[model samples]
Target: MAPSFGIMTAPSQVDYADVLRVWREADTVPEIEHAWLFDHLMPIFGDPAGPTYEGWTLLSALAAHTRRLRLGVMVTSNRFRPPALLAKIATTVDIVSGGRLDFGIGVGSRPSHPLARREYDAHGLPFHDAAYAVAGLAEACTLIRRLWTEDEPFDFHGTQHRLTGAFGSPKPVQRPHPPILIGGRSSATLRVAAEHADIWNIPGGDIDDVTRRSALLDRYCKDIGRDPANLTRSIHLPVSYDRPGDTRAAIREAIDAGFRHLVLGLPAPYPADVARWTADELIGPSA
Candidate 1:
């Protein structure tokens, strides 16, 4: 598959509907298997006041608009929704998208606005601790997967969640469950991905940095005696092509280094620069 490439439409200051249209057009681009959209309440990188779209709402719209192209939240915050509710949401999205849903979830990064009990600074809540957060995420994943895959009534008891005699109806279209993707580069994150994630999405970093982090994940998977092949390695890269043929070389370079997915963040202004960048750097003949 030559390392499938996709676009991560960072809704930072861009028009959501317009980006959705571009993504829908990308379905005809032949090389794109998935079109990833980030789930964040605020801009983590750019100016804080910039416009940012809510992730799931955007994805739900994308599900309605896109066909053939897989749709996903690059990584959603497990802290934002109850595990049982999230399970149903993923299942619903999968059914609606005809099995094209990929659920990428993570512990919330930075304290969420109108913050609740799960964030770093909320009173009476534990601060950001890797061990505790990983445990919580593992519990959530276990519960969510059981809710989706188990036939008989299921009960889950863990450090963070407990469920009894509850079941989710209309199981996801994907057998067993929709693919679970965990995003992060920390050791705990790697361990979680090795244990529970079908895909690991790392932040954009240099090849050597990515390789090193990936080796850590591979080692963790090996220690657990889980075949690394079962885990997919994906990277989110910020790419721009000012001239013809620039992005292709970078694409080839990433593929050579074992990146299975490359998500290029198109610059803002939905109809102008983003469209041109998508055509030239993402889906163009040179790309």
Candidate 2:
């Protein structure tokens, strides 16, 4: 089978128009399966109020323009939107795309990043303890999945979210909902992915790093009686436009290391020549 590939339109300073251009161009390529965005209310770096369009809204708009491409965030910050509403939005996007949706999500607010904390502070969102974050993510995974698949309304009670007779209507177009890609590298994260995710997404790393982490995820899968083979492994690769060969090498290596899906990142305002090269050299043959 051909390798599945996707792109992350750099979520920084680029205007939404250029992003729409990229997404439209990328969707026409058979090699490109999906386009991803980051869930951030504020800029990840530089100015906090940078020109970052909302991820969900962007996907919603992109859905109207594209034909075959799937839409998703690299991993939505679960705290950025409430669980049930998030599920509703995702289902709507899936419907719009005619089942072309890959629903990726993760907990919000990284402890190591002060900017994330600052973003949360500015928005009055809590940066909770690690335990709370992990447990909440697990519960969220369960709730969202249920919301997408359940026929009857159900009450849900969890440490971070509670719903009474939650009636998530218009179930997703994909059976049992779209594939959920769980993100993060910590042990808690791996465990949650093993239990709930159809795909496991981690930041791109060297061959040895991918090997080591793949083994770790396998262990987590077995501990819970889930087969590791059932989970699709993906890497988020940050590529430099000047280093095309480096991008190809990393992608080839990741493919050799058993990663089936790639989340690719290009520089903002991707140059025309570079984008063409990405399509011809990197993505075309892989597909």
Give the winner by lDDT.
2
Residue 7's lDDT within candidate 1 is: 77
User: Which candidate should be chosen as best, given TM-score against the real structure?
Assistant: 2
**Candidate 2 local Cα displacement, residue 217, angstroms:** 1.0
lDDT of 1 by residue, 55-145 (tens): 8777877888878888899888776677898899888889889999989998756444442333333223344555767777888888899
Q: Give lDDT tens digits, candidate 2, residues 155-200.
A: 9878779899998889999997899999988888888999999999
User: Worst lDDT window (10 residues) for model 1?
Assistant: 115-124
